[model samples]
Target: MNKTLVAGALALTLAGCASQQPAPPFTLTLAHINDTHSHFDPSDARLTLDHKAVFTRLGGHPRLLSHVNELRRQAEEAEQPLLFVHGGDAWQGTGYFTLNQGAMNADVLSRMQLDAMALGNHEFDIDNQRLAAFIQGVNFPVLAANLDASHDPDLKGLENLKPYVLYAFDGHEKERVDSVKDAGKRPVVAVMGLVLEDMPDMAAHTGNLRFEREVDSAQRTVRALREQGVKQIVAVTHLGLERDQRLAREVNGIDVIVGGHSHSLLGQFSNLGWADGAPYARQFTNPDGRGITCVVQAGQFAQAMGQVSVTFTPDGRVSRCEGGNTLLSDNVFYRDIRRGEQHRLNEQQTQRLKAEIASQPNIAMVAEDPALRAHIDKQYLPALNRAYGEVIGHLPQALKHVRLPVDGSGSQIAPLVAASQLYWANTPEVLAVTGRRADFALVAAGSVRNSLEPGALKEGHVGLELLPFANPISLVSLTGRQVAGLLLETINASLPADAHTGKFPYAAGLRYTFNETSKGRGYLDRIEFLSQGHWQRIEPDTRYQVVLNSYHASGNDGWSTFFDSQQAFTDRLDLAFTNGKLTAFPVARLSKVNGGGVQVHYINQPLNCQDQAVRCNTDARAFIDYVRERRPMLTALPESGVTLKRL
Candidate 1:
């Protein structure tokens, strides 16, 4: 053979081998928000600055959309693949959801151009039929691989509700690169949604849909995607941060997890008096021990946006992950002073704080998107304005709401809320119906969505924003033992301190001590009852008249003890705003136990509005009336209501 011919053949062989080599690592960017909970307007957020509390506003859909759109523009200019998603809980946080239901959510969210969304547990806050309607109304597909909606007539075979959504990025035109077939031989990215397997416990109206375990569902989905030649996998999950980490560790082939449900602020913010959760985009070692999965979650209530840029190798392992949660806020800042007046921050101080915020990776001062803001103003702000205008009371001091009690102190406002319920129960009309005044009232920590800042308290703050759920006040009788057991069951359900913290209990007219080392009685060491202005040990055999929100009264949110004890009792009564009057009636009962032992019930009984009786309202109404009439200043309790002891 000629020498030149042999050399040319060798060069061609080397060129063919190079073509077969795996592709270089590619970059993809994601802009995400979770647990937005219908915050279409800026919300009050407090941060410590210069040893003083600075009141400012954070997020809202408009601001969040601005941040996301800018990021998308930047990514498009850079010719990088990008996606925007919502982790979950897009409904039921503010007055908008209270008034407009899912219509407003679908309309506003559809405008944001989301690639996909996780079917958050709150989406089931209504029912399967309503959820199906919302899904149909939204432009983006709602993904939920673990959900088997076959039993639900409305959800089964729903066109927009999918197990997974696929995307493929070509060299340019990021917006047009959704189909895998369009990009021949290019890597496809699969995004799947995973909700809580025990979703019915958190959301009562999930209907007949069944939730499979998160880990098993994720693994199965990833395996299927891998077999189909999809390399990059993202799980947009409603599982809290802890569960996301667990899924990352237990499962294989997951590249990233965009998580919600815990409302975790997954970045450094402790210096501002905020919880510095685990760093955003932190990689967890996969089950294979070599592959890496990055997890990211923005804080709740439309307060933050999570922007993550990931570098993925050919085999779908996360090579490098960056980005953190950015808290979008307005330029305004204030401090409370004498006579409950808000002192606006000076220009110099505002500039200094803004400079500091700019230096931080997790906070951004962004202006609201004008078009979205205008749309909200035209379509939604009228009802919210009316709701916010009604001043219910005033708070002289700020009260923080921490779900898990720390240093033997629980939520300041939760106790106040419970006291309000107790006040309603003791009202003459309510007492007459119950045949006696109530002993105490208990409310879940989750029921109180926000802390009470020192300011003019509005009716919307309680009814539309804080306790926005339509839960009524219900009265029940329980022995001291059952009361103790109820507390234990709820506290244990919120255990591990990282997940399900919402179920932690807070009370008024009662107090308890928790011992960490004591396994006996599920860490509840002591129980006390307030009697004649003195604390006394509760008598286990004594039947006490207790007032609780209807949600807990029905055993939702892991309050199984409430359901177990009350399910068989015919004495349960719910206080409702019937015909504009507060009236008591028999608690609604389900025909039978459903999946997860949840006894679904509804207030379907017909009532005569013509009957002569004093009308009253429940839930937020009770709290509003209590604040306006009983304690406008909202002072702390006489003594700490909780004590914690460690081994």
Candidate 2:
């Protein structure tokens, strides 16, 4: 009797424990990519496998789509939640975007049936008229809460664009269809769109549209979404990672943030095999003391896709979250387990990882997507070939800077570009807008896409290398003091303090000496501007003209000084009003050239649709025109780093 009573007691205790089990939590798996930049191609990228360098095809749309689908299959099998998101800048970058004007990208991305996408600044590169047309191809909603486009009739035409949207997705063992939730209904997820308010500074600004404050728009959106019983709110944004973190902390009810614009790499060092970058997903708590918001970004060009698994409590609070980026390297990754846990993926695990990765469908290892390539070959390639394939000039020696040590310097291309841009800015066509001739040239080292190679260089090579984005050249007037200050900043950002700085200023008719002891604006020992055949000291407050690509003049890369002077710029280089006494060439009168050459590029002028008037306006065309004028053989620069020096 005693033994039976003991057994019964134990059974009753076990029964109580079984009855008190935890509730089933709502789970979601977010698969995302950002800043694709129309890289619908698989290019050769170098990586280390088993401690040795290996060349591999890193990314392409087909491979990216296959990876996404593979992950989707895995998620569905496990009954985990899944959502595919793009961070933005879907257009602008490669030859693909330049030739097709984002149509091909739109067509391809639309086929993915994306849940949502933020309107990146590059989306406005073609202006509002083209964006509206691009929207027509997208089946999914393209979001932006801050941009007030209702005033623009062209934007008003697109009925799909809105401040925020509601999406109902069920992750539990129940439904397949993800649709919009109705009033008073429960939603598995609700995503809102928020774009950076500084559109005027970043993209092509329009008169009819204005941007609202990001935080204010986000807070209002969260409050509205919450009132409708929306529990999980994800913010798809182009405000970049830093701002995303602040937005998550300052605003309540944001459960996740998918972002772009910085083209940053964020992931764990152990899992990612990269030491520098933000973790794949970082959790931030709101100041209001509510649920935490998880933020993530998949690096540029679909190189990797971030997969996040999140569990939320019944009351819409985050319970737990975990995930990281899956490197779409399309090659085997190996690590020695003998090293430690930090290494991750030993022999067996690496094999399993590679095998599983290989199981997914993929295309051949080529620089471009097969679909895009076929499309290009069929139509676009013919035009580009006919337009830019001619052997207009020859490079006797290869010009490169990839291995240079002058603070992220490239080969001879750096000085060559500085010479070429300065040459064009001095040209009759480019000089008219500013009403002043360029005294010197300034270019960012990062602007040299690839070094010019030896042998026969076609016009296409120019597009391939220097003008991947075809940025137009422009001129800016800076005081000698401002030029000195700019050089000081550039030197401070370089080694022995920071080894590699792509922002290192490359100048043709300019040079600066610096002392390592000082920093900030005083690092430069002296500044010089080459005028005629002599070098003269750059005096503070004395006006000097600097010519550069649109990238640098817009204060992108590192040259931050120019950001304050953005409005003073004219349409490229144009002869315009009143910059002193208009000494020489046709004041306020535009120059139309005679029939010496057929112009394929849009001439830089002070009009909104200046680029639209021509087929191309790339740095390539400018450099090509420069080379053709001095053709037969191009002269190479001095052997050593002769652009600058230490006093």
Candidate 3:
């Protein structure tokens, strides 16, 4: 053979040899779900214009199982190893979960075959013993490197739970290589779980367990796993996304962090940079520096599942990855029978799941308790009768009632109820009015669950009818400016004239108006405070001792302004009522107006219909309009003017 031809043949042979070499890497799929909260049934059903039933379907364990099965099948088809994980908060949100001590949730979770679960605060809502029982019942491990379970009775049993788990997936080629190579050649993946440090206070009732900071616990776990020969590390974090990001940046060795708590919808993995001091942005970095750490979370409820697929090269470094969060609810595989459309789960599978749910007893207890039923009979109804005693007067006709006015503003009902609560509390030197003040009475209209009727007034009715979700009274203090800011935020967030007719409204004794056209966000452009018996301008710098429920005081519903104030005081509202003096008086007559200094009037229009305008000022009119619009949207309105006193 010619020398040139032989040289060309040798080069071709070398090229063929290179083509026969092993493929690049192996891929693994990580599937995760969080905050299922034991919602066995779907959301409520409403009728559409087509007269067809439209259901807001949501979480159910069986449906979740169906989703897992499908995802596993897809992963298998794609030649990826699948690992299922849970980012906790699986217990105590619903009635069934509470009543069963999390048994139902545990059963469902075990059935799903979860590989690991990060401890969530709600897991400790039940006592430690029950939590231990739940842990014993589950087949999978609860991962929490931070939870100190040594001393507490409730958490002592958890000492057996592993802080981390390592998984090995061997594909055909890897298996062949393993058989030919040394025994230590198999590839392994490690997962670590870390609970949030705030779990101790949040889940205080669960037991006397202590939790270290998430970042510290995660760092220790990563070090330990690395020592144990873990090639790839994933941290299952139950901390909120903010803390999760902090963990990803602070902890160096983790390859991926599956996080929960804040219910973030992370569609795909993203880079989280270190704190301002770190040298570089925190990215996924494997042992060999071939890949970056990926972090992901699926939103609350079982509405969606998160998938992270990572491919590892022969050297144990992640080479390539591709995955996205998927919404099982939108899939065509499960049919939404209520929608009259064939969608996801086949009819047989759907029925079986439904049967499984139906077989479970006491699930309805998740929403309402039998104790509430008893209270309605023995305590609530009688209290209503006594409070509304001696029919003072009667409505001329059956007038339409609204919880709040249609306009985007505050409702009168909330302040009225707050005043009633204060009256019941009978605090010494307490200022009683429907208005805003630092260390003064403030209540949200959304907290008012019932309304009064248009019939003859009777005793006990006010106690029974007005607010059904009678929360324990909580008190908090704030400055006048802080109070004002809270009120403004509530109104601005609720009523933007450009939005819908009915939105959340603010109810206060202080008079306030906004120029919907001029003021950005339409906050309190016009403000008045009730003083002695007249409306007066409120000074921004003034400080006042305010009494409000913990709900509003804690800045729920955009009331963060309260938190920005000076020194604040707090106590339960129910305790305030029970401990303070109480008095009962006869209802001589119903007055159109109570003690007031600030009067509210609509800027351009009547608050309500002429016939319904008897006591309708601007505040009342705006509230009526707001309520009228939202009536169709709510399940039920607060029983009008009814109050419940806890003794």
In the range 574-622, model 1's lDDT, one tens digit per residue, is: 7776656556677555333454636635455533322454232377878
For candidate 1, what is the total of clashing residue pairs?
A: 4
TM-score per prediction, in order, is: 0.91, 0.74, 0.55
Off by over 4 Å in 3: 1-24, 44-56, 75-79, 157-160, 171-185, 204-207, 268-291, 330-471, 476-647
* Tens digit per residue, CA lDDT, model 3, 473-551: 4334445676567766665554432221112333333555554444335445655555665767767787554544443
Q: What is the Cα root-mean-square deviation between model 3 and the actual structure?
A: 15.7
Clashing pairs counted in every model: 4, 9, 74
Q: What are the lDDT scores of the predictions, listed in order?
A: 0.81, 0.65, 0.51
Using TM-score, rank the candidates from best to worst.
1, 2, 3
lDDT of 2 at 29: 80
TM value for model 2: 0.74
